[model samples]
Target: MSDSSINLDELRQRIDQLDGDILRLISERAACAQKVAHVKLAHDKDAVFYRPEREAQVLRRIMSLNEGPLDSEEMARLFREIMSACLALEQPIKVAYLGPEGTFTQQAALKHFGESAISLPMAAIDEVFREVEAGAVNYGVVPVENSTEGVVNHTLDTFMDSSIHICGEVVLRIHHHLLISDTTRRDKISRIYSHPQSFGQCRKWLDAHYPHAERVPVSSNAEAAKLVKTEWHSAAIAGDMAAKLYGLERVADKIEDRPDNSTRFLIIGSHQVPMAGEDKTSIVVAMRNQPGALHDLLEPFHRHKIDLTRIETRPSRTGVWNYVFFIDFKGHVDEPRVAAVLDEVRLRASELRVLGSYPQGVL
Candidate 1:
């Protein structure tokens, strides 16, 4: 064999040896973690199997120990699975997402839960919260904000009365596409259907191309895709997944106003999530409509060096146009700095509700 070929073979052999060693080490580590779970349970008299603190420590240690030819982010993600598996050795997780399946919420659900979860799809945002509240699901995924348009009002409003806490979050890139039935006639298109959100995301593209086509709003992107199947003259604006799931052909893709348009989703559950060094908290504060009310509510956060990630105004629902500002910020609610900010804000606002504190969503 050529010298270079012989060298390649030797490298492959080494990689195979390393892979086996890594697997063996992971299995041993899992056994050790399970033992830790038992010890924690005995001491705490609660479920010690899922220690968010230990999970965070494991991930941080993995990053610290990594001398990676692989990216640190990639290494951490792989280790997240290891911790997830170890945790599951103690308990398997059940997650809920907003969907009829093929919805963006499902994408966020997968991102948050990894592959080791039982994911249930719900028909409405409130239904997702209901499932979590009812203990029918362990975690619920729902949209909270969109970069292009604004907050998902339904999700924010659900927060108004719901008692379920936000446990984690995920952000998903929103992509819009124009899809049609296989038999659709390109020249005879009359009306288009999509969820209002999807239509809003693709508004500029639609106006410039199909200025005369009637735009109709449906309950969801999937429903719009389903509508197109019954009528050959109508096309649906949805994501690639919807098109694929409905067996529709895409005539247009990436049609959103901007390429970076994305939505932030929240994972809601009953438990208060432990601090994962990098975390975020969401709170809803209702202030009496006074001049500089927002400033007064935000002042404490600024003083505490808490970073505000999002702020959206919604009708207070107690009265029309008496708006409440929904604010999301960095740092877990359990942290001292964040707790202080909330305490101060609570004193200033008429009403203060902690939506939840959770780990910041990663792409």
Candidate 2:
């Protein structure tokens, strides 16, 4: 045999052996998870199948221990799926996301919960919050902010009236593609469909290229992708999942004006999550309408030297709400420094509500 042929044969043999070994290990892990399920069932009839803090710790450890040809994030994703399957052996988790199916929120849901999870799509952000609040689903995922477009106000506004807690977070890097169905007239495209935020992110690009095209804002990129499937003169701006789900072709890829466009999605549930070492706490403070109200609200955080990730102000929904500040900061609520800051803020604010402290996004 030729030298190259011999090397190829050996490599194939080695890969086959490794595949078998991996299969065995995965089966063993699933078996162990099943054993865990039985033990929990014996102790508590309503044992939660998933633990946000525990999952975060595992993913972080996987990334930390990785010294691989595969990137840390990539390796962590593989383990994510593995864990998801094992968790299904314990119990399948039902999650709701804002969507008509095939939206970026759905992608974030799948990424965080894995394919083994049962993900349901809701029409709006409030619906996602409502689902978890009603106990219709075990958890919900909703977009909180986009790197290119700032905060999602609707999500923040929902927190003011809802009791659902933030249990975890997931960040999805967005890459918008101009997609068209097989029957779409590429040359006759006069209208482009996409979510408003997707259009906003790609404004410069749109103006430079298809400036004359009518930009129509829809409920979601998935809905946009769905609409174009029957329209001959329209193209949809959406992501890869939508494109595949609807059998569309990419007319242009990664057309977002910002290359690093990403959206942060929060996991909402009925229960508060314990600290996962690295954590973030979200709170809404209704400030008294007075001088230095803004400054007074932030002073405690600065004094404690706590890292603030984001701060957004929304018009209060209640009669008492003149201005409500939504704050996200580093450190779990259980920590002394965070507790001290909250105590100070509580004294200054008319009202305060801790949304939930959750593990920081790991993958």
Candidate 3:
């Protein structure tokens, strides 16, 4: 046999041995996870099987300890799947996301919970909240903001009426592609379908290429992809999952105007997550319609040196001219400074609600 062939055969044999070791280790981890479930159940009848903070800490540690040809994120993702699978053996988790099956929110849900999770698709953001609130699902995933399009106001508005708490968050880099079905006539395409935000994201690209094509706004990019499956003269602007789900081909990839386009999704549940070293807190503040009300509300955070991540204003459902400010900031509420800041803000504001203090997104 050739030396190269012998070397390749030996490498293959080594890989086979490593695979066996990996499988055995994974099995042992699964058994350990099962034992953990038994212990928790023995201690408390209604013990929560999932811990967002714990999972976040594990993934973060995996990322920090990783030193490999594969990047930290890639390594962490592998560990995430393993953890997810082991957790399923302990107790399967059901999650709901804003969807009709194939949307960015669904992708975010899978990314956060892993494929082992049972994911249900709800037609609206509020429905996702309802499912989680009703105990029909363990958690829910909904879009909070887009890098290009700003906040999803519907999501924010839904939060104002709901009692759901944020457990964790996941950020997905969005890459919209111009996709078509097998029957689509690329040259003869006269109509395009997409969510309004998607059209806005790919506006420049569409204007430069298919200016005359009628831009039809739909409920979601998934719906747009579904529509293109039957229309030969139509194309859809959507992400990879939708295209793959609908069996559509990408005519133009990554057509979003900005290369750095991304969206942040929130994981909502009933329980408050514990701190995982790095954390973020979300609160809604309703200030009386008066001069310097905003200033009064923000002064405490400034004084405490708390890093504010985002601040969004929505018209309050209460009295006229009243507004509610959705604020996101660094630090968990359990911390002294953060608690003090909240106490000060509460004194200045007409109404304030700390939605949640959760671990910042690790992946």
Candidate 4:
């Protein structure tokens, strides 16, 4: 046999052996998870099997211990699926995301929970929150902010009234593509359809290229992609998921004006997550109308040397004179310094609510 043929045969044999080892190890892990479920049931029938803090720790440890040709994130993502499958064996869970099945929110949900999870599509952001609150789903994923377009006000507003906690977070890098189905006429494209947020994200590109095309704002990019599938003279601006779902060709890829346009999504659940080394806490503070109310609310954070990631102001719904400030910081609420800061802020504000402290997005 040729030396090259011998090398190829040896390499394929090694890979097959490795695959067999991986399969056995994964089966052992799933069996252990099933035993854990039985133990929890014996201890308490209502015990929650899905623990976000534990999942975060496992992923972080995998990333830290990885010494591979594959990058850290890529390696972590592979383990994510394994953990997801094991968790399903422990107890299968359902997650809800903003709808039509092809949106970026759905991608985020799948990214966080893995493919083994049952992900349902909700019609709106509020509905995602409602499903979680109503116990119809185990968790919900909703967009909180975008790098290009800023915060999602509807999502922020929904948090103001809901009792649900942010158990985790997932950040998805967005790439908008100009899509056309087989029926679409590339030369005669006259109308462009997309969600208003997507249109805003791709405003510069649209203005420069399709200046004359009638722009229609639909409920979602997925819906727009669906619409263009049946129209011969129309095109849609959406992501790869939508294109793949609707079987559309990408005429223009990465049409977003910014190369790094991304959105941060929050995982909403009923339980508060325990500390997982790296964490972020979100809170809403309602302040009475006064000259130094804002300053007073922020001073505690500055004094405690807590790193504030983001702060957004929303008009209070209860009273015109009151202003609500949504604050995100880089520590868990259980920490001493974070607790001190919250106490001081509570004394200074009319009302305070700690949304949740969850592990920072690892994968």
Candidate 5:
């Protein structure tokens, strides 16, 4: 045999041996996870099988320890799947996300929780909250904000009325594509369908290419993709998940105006997550409708040097011209400095509710 062929054969044999070792180790890990479930169940009948903080820590550690041809994130993602599978052996988790099965929120849910999770789709953001609030699902995922389109006000408004807590968060980079079905007449495409935000993201691209095409706003990009499947003269602007789900072909890929377009999704649940070293806390503050109310609200955070990640204002339902502020900042509430800041802010604001203090996104 040639030297190159012999080398390739030896490499293949080494890989096969490594695969066997990996399989055995994974089995051992699964057995250990099963034992953990038994121990927890033995002590507490209703013990929670999933720990967001713990999972976050593991993924973060895996990323930190990785030194290979594969990047840290890619390595962490592999570990995340392994952890998810082992957790399923302990107890399967149910998650709800805003969807008709193929939206970005669904993608975010799958990214945050692995494929082992049972994911349900809700028609509206409020419905996602309701599912988690009613205990129908273990957790819910909802889009909080987009890098280009700003905040998802519907999600913020739903949070105002719901008692659900934020468990964790995941950020997904969005890439909208112009998609068509097999029957679509490429040249005869007279209408385009997409969510309003998607149209905004891809406005420049559409204007430059298909300016004459009627831009039809729909409930979601998934719905747009679904509509295109039946329309011969229509195309949809949506993400890869929607296109794949509807079996549509991409006519134009990554047509979003900005290359850095992304969306942040929140994982909502009943339980408060413990600190995972690096953490972020979300709170909603209702200030008295008076001069310097906003100043009073933000002074504590600034004074404490707490890094604020996001701050958004929504009209309050209580009174005229009243506004509630949704604030996200670094540090867990269990810490002395963070607790001090919250205490000070509570004294100044009319109402302050800490939504959650969870580990920042690991992947």
Candidate 6:
């Protein structure tokens, strides 16, 4: 029998009771987190820390175990916010990202900490790194690479000198939309604005649709969206969030050249997170550019049975003729095998920098 066939008052009472139980459980979970913080502090340990591997595993587990209409991402976000609040209660953390406000990095900051943590916006990527380095922000988010456009060289080059660790990684699905100010006159747009990545991703689409429009590069998509609202002859290629925030008209949706285009962002912090099953370790290795040097360094991983995920070469800042290979693999430094691989790599390379490892973001 359904609620309509039963006594309405009794059915309402049952739902109310269920809600009470849910509230009680939420309270219990929060209390337990506080206790965990207390226990860690008692042991003279750091209570507040970001564990990317743990987060990735948690979200993945939640997705695997999901049995409802809410979807895995929905459930993961709900729990993520709760964990963020609990950690903030233990100790509030401040994060800095490239922004004036309402930027994609800000969205990344929210993804990392939910609504509980505070976020500070810096004008440039270097500033984001500097703020984190200076202890002005506990963490920072910056785009490392795009699926379509390749690696962000600035971020890669910045790592050569900074001591920040890569605590997590978030892969964001990117969608570009053409937003126009309502006041825009004439169907012929004189200018288009967006972040360079957005512009590049949507290049073909724009070339075909609006060949004569002046494509202008801006610092961020949000800034581009803001600019469109003020310029009657201009349109912005930005995400849904930017379009909505600026109250611009979404003339076209998913206007990027490819649907699978995504950006990989890195979470930079000062501590190494413990392994939580699935994790990624990033490190920069400088080896002799000789025939067997690369082979020697990579052979140890195969010997140790480690799965290397990504390997990229960047010109070494020490000299124009030299280069460093940055690698990402699916294992934590704490694992004996992983540790052994690193030890072996250290002996083979002239210089090695562990970029730190953390749980991967499931998104």
lDDT of 1 by residue, 253-328 (tens): 8899989999888878888878878888888889988899888988888888888988888888888779888888
Candidate 6 lDDT trough over 10 residues, lowest sum: 46-55
**Predicted structure 5, TM vs. truth:** 0.99
Residue 16, model 6: lDDT of 100
How high is the lDDT of residue 61 in model 4?
Answer: 94
Off-target runs (Cα >4 Å) in candidate 4 are none
Q: Which is better, 3 or 6, measured by TM-score? A: 3
Candidate 2 per-residue C-alpha lDDT over 1-363 given as tens digits, one digit per residue, 9 for 90 to 100: 999999999999999999999999999999999999999999999998799999999999999999999999999999999999999989999999999999999999999999999999999999988889888999999999999998998999888888889999999999999999999999999999999999999999999989999999999999999999999999999999999999999999999998999999999999988889999999989988999999999988888899999889899876665889899999999998899999999999999999999999998
lDDT of 6 by residue, 85-173 (tens): 87787777799988867787888788878889898889999999999889888899999999999898889889998988988888888
* lDDT (10s digit) by residue, model 3, range 1-363: 999999999999999999999999999999999999999999999999999999999998988898898999999899989999999998889999988889998999999999899999999999999999999999999999999999999999999999999999999999999999999998999999999999988989999999999999998999999999989999999999998899999999999999999999999999998889999999999987889998999998898899999999999988777889999999999999999999988888889999999999998
Each prediction's TM-score versus the true structure: 0.87, 0.97, 0.98, 0.98, 0.99, 0.91
What C-alpha lDDT values do all the predictions have? 0.83, 0.94, 0.94, 0.93, 0.94, 0.86
Model 1 ranges with Cα > 4 A deviation: 29-68, 185-189, 229-231
List ranges where model 2 is wrong by over 4 Å.
Answer: 319-321
Candidate 3: where is the Cα deviation over 4 Å? none
Worst 10 residues of 1 by lDDT: 46-55
Clashing pairs in 6: 52-359, 53-359
Lowest lDDT 10-mer window, candidate 5?
A: 60-69
Q: What local lDDT score does residue 331 receive in model 1, on the 0 to 100 scale?
A: 90
**TM-score, cand. 2 vs. native:** 0.97
Q: Write the per-residue lDDT of candidate 4 for residues 118-184, one digit (tens) a residue.
A: 9999899999989999999999999999999999999999998899999999999999999999988
The regions of model 5 sitting more than 4 angstroms off are none
For candidate 1, give the lDDT of residue 333.
74
Q: Evaluate model 3: give its lDDT.
A: 0.94
